[model samples]
Structure formats: C-alpha cells, structure tokens
Target: MTSTAREAELLPAEDAATYAEWFACLAEPTRVRLLQAVAVAGSKSVGELTEQLGISQSTCSHHVRKLAEVGFVALNKQGTTTRVSINPACCTGLPHAADAVMGVLAPRPCCPDNLACDVTVRPLEAGDWSAVRRIYAEGIATGNATFETEVPTRRALESKWLPGHRWVAELEGEIAGWAAASQVSNRTCYAGVAETSVYVGDAFRERGVGKALLHKQVTAADTDGLWTLQTSIFPENRASLALHHSAGFRTVGFRERIAKHRGIWRDTVLLERRRSVESPE
Candidate 1:
C-alpha cells in the first residue's frame, strides 16, 4: 500500500481521542434524539425539547448538558428560558468523522459497476461542441439543473473548464451526456480543488449514461492529481445526488435559501469528495 493509504487508515492519536470524547457524549439514545431535535428545529427551549422527545425535563437537561460539553450543542439564555441549538460545525464535522472511521473516506479506483456496457465515454473532441451544448440546453430547460437561463457559449465553457478533464459520453455513437471540471479559484493554493458539472441529454435520462460519464470523469480527476471535487445540486434532483454519492461524494451541508432561481428562492445541497490518498507524483 502507498504511504498515503497508510496515513488515511490510521487517524492521529489526538484526533481519535477528541472524536471519542465527542462520540461518548452522545452515547445515550436520549442524547442522540436531543441533538437531532435541536438540529431540526434550529433551536429549542429545554421544555420544548422535553415535550417533543417525550422525556422528562430533568433527563433532557442532563443529556443536553452532556452534548453541550462536547461542543455538539450550544446553550443560550434569554430571560429565564435556556435554549439549546446544535453547533453548526457538527453538521459537517460529524459526517466527516464517520467517513474517516469507515474506510470510505479513502479514495478508491474507478467505480463503474453495472453500467451500460455499450455506452462509451471519451475525452471531449472539437466536433462534440454542438451535442454538448444541446445537452446542456436540455438540462437548463429542466429548471433543476442550474440557475443559468441559457447554456453558456462554447468559448465561455472552454475557457472555464479545465483542459484535459472535459469528457463526453456516447450511446450508440451519439453524444448522450457530458461532464467537466472547472477551476474553483485562480489562486495557486486552490489549484487542486474544482467544481464539477454533468448533464445528460433529454433522450438519455435513465440509460446509465450519467453513471458511465461520472465514472470516467472521477477516475480521470484522480489520475490528474486533483485533490478535491465539489458540486452544488438542487435538492429536488435525486438522481443526480445518487449518482455522485456512488462516485464517493458526501453531503457537506445544505445551503438553505442560498440563491434565487427564476424569481423564487431555492436551496442547494453542497457536496464534495476529497482524494482518499495522495497519488504518487
């Protein structure tokens, strides 16, 4: 195994202890339910949580104190009422902690299983622009793909997408979908992090075209030494979410009321996948 893999397999002693402390605080079923209640309600008074959880006030108070000690929940005082709210950091940190404990945090090889064998994924060629943009247009029409009203011009897309990381999927020799990674920032420090986008043509919605394209896209990103890939997906797009999750992506957080799409507010699910271990230089 590579040194990077070894490092991922073993968490630091200090971190393990810290994580253990946090986990220990939530060992009780009541504490877990308490945290969940606070997380969903955003904030709740002790009495409110007690009533919602069907637990006694004293028992709820004791468990809330335990969770607060580990920074899982925060306490606020307004007049005589003490309200408990979940620590926003825990929203992302705890999931990452779970991923670390389970070996899924480590990057693995391409995961193109049970995909349609006839669908071919190839690097985007110059002649593929027409089909690529047409597919993008289809995605725009769905009102769930992106906030953009129209497909970006080919020149604009080419300049934004990272060279050598653009791809096209073909079903029976016709372009069915496309995937590409765009540099998230111009700073040298963020060169390895990218925001990715994928779209399937209207005719190719459920034929495993997305699964095949993502397999090629993620594998290529790993080989090219990219360390992080992130994407924002509309919460309503369940198919896209499942596809990315299969490729090792995890939900980092939800951006509620994040932006306006067509004159109405919309929420987005922010997701990211980090390289499991560094590839050899």
Candidate 2:
C-alpha cells in the first residue's frame, strides 16, 4: 500500500466479513445461475426457477434458500407458490462489495482544494466545440493520451458525454483543458457509474489546468449523484496519473497490454474514485 492507502480508510473488518459470507454463499455454480435468472426475470416461482434453469425443484429451492440467507434474494409466498426476487440492494451491494474486496474504493474530498489559481473552470457550452476540439486534437496528437488516432467529431463527443458532467478550464480566457464523464453502461444498475477523462492542452501541461478541470469535474459528479468514477491511463503518462492522484483516484490495477496503439501493445494503469452515495434503499 502507498501513502495514499495509509492515509485513506481501509475496509472495515466487519464489512469484509459480511462480504465474505455473501461471496461464500454464492460459491455454488447452481446458486449463481439461479440468482442471475431471478435478477433478470424479476420474481420467479420455484417452479419457474426450476424450469428456466433446468434444475430439479428441490435443488432450486435449496439454492434460493442459500441466496436468501445472505440477503441476496428475497422470497415471497403468493398462494401456494414461493416467489423469489433479487434483492434491490444487491444491485448496488454486490458491486460495492467487489470494489471493497479489491480495494478500489475512494472516500476522498469532494474536490482538491489546491486548484489552479489562474484557471477558471466552467460548464462546457455549445460554442466551445471549436476550442474543445482543438484541445482534444492536442491530446490525440500525444499518442500516449489515448488510443484515438484523431480527434472525435463534436457531434460524436456530445452524444457520448453526460450532459451536465462536461466541463472546460479557461486559463487567461483561453481553453486550457477539459474534463468529462460518460456512462459506463446504459443499464440501470450502473446508472451512477461513469468513466472519466481529463485532457490538458500541450502548452498548459504542468500549469495545474488538469487539476483545475478535475476539481470541477469530480465535485460536480458528487453533487450530481455519481457513485463511482474510473479511468485508465498508459503507464508512461506519469503526469496525468499524478494529476488524477491529487484528486484522490487510486490505481486499482495494472492492465497488461490491454490494447494496441500504432501497432504496439500498451499497458494501462486503471484508476478509480468512489464517492460515497446515499442509498434510497
């Protein structure tokens, strides 16, 4: 663990024990299959579970009971049939537990306070496309910034980014950098999770423009109800990695040669920040 991990909170022993129990309870392949079926099709009678999963009724009932014991599934009795439904909390709880076990959680400040004094961060505007593309082109030109060989078209970017999460930084009235977060998935289960990207113009590197943009981006995400933000950077991009770390992102993994760029395979350092979101459940 780095100083950051020492400074950051670790998963509590009790929580870890509970997560272990949850994990252990689903260790059987049949139970995993049963849980998936219930989650996908809403409530299911034991007969429906048995038929859909092609298992015997006794086996289905046994596995459903195991899942219920760990609170992963709920059982209801309607008439003589027992209806099994996935727990609403499991939608969030399972992913959170995985993050906890992997030590990918980030309980940090809303944003870094040491934001660039000379930079002003603001919501991206329609007319900012020209400058935004120019800055994006700068990032694309740096082969290490992304796997993209060319800057994305404005329409393409606009459609991809979450509307309110797009932001830009102005240094001396010029666009110096930009930051945005996009949905990690369209599924409702992952509605509050996003993948983040920060790009600083080449000339603005080391001027704190990246941090300034990130300060606004992350804090806005927290206020806007994002629970987790993640990004991947090439291992060689130390400056970008440092800027993200200042914003409290932790390296979750080192993806070995995860993709190719310019005919060469490249490794990426996966980083993530988890904002503690209040659960309606």
Clashes of 1: 1
TM-score per prediction, in order, is 0.72, 0.63
What is the per-residue lDDT of model 1 for residues 1-281, given as tens digits with 9 covering 90 to 100? 58877886687898789889988887898899889999998999999999998989999999999999989999999998999988999998888788777765655555547789899999999999999999999999999999998889999999999998999999977999999999999999999999999999999889999999888887788888888899999999999998898888888889999999999999999998877665533
Off by over 4 Å in 1: 1-24, 27-93, 97-109
Report lDDT (CA) for all predictions.
0.89, 0.87
Q: Give the winner by TM-score.
A: 1
lDDT of 2 by residue, 61-110 (tens): 99999999999999999899999998999988998889777755646565
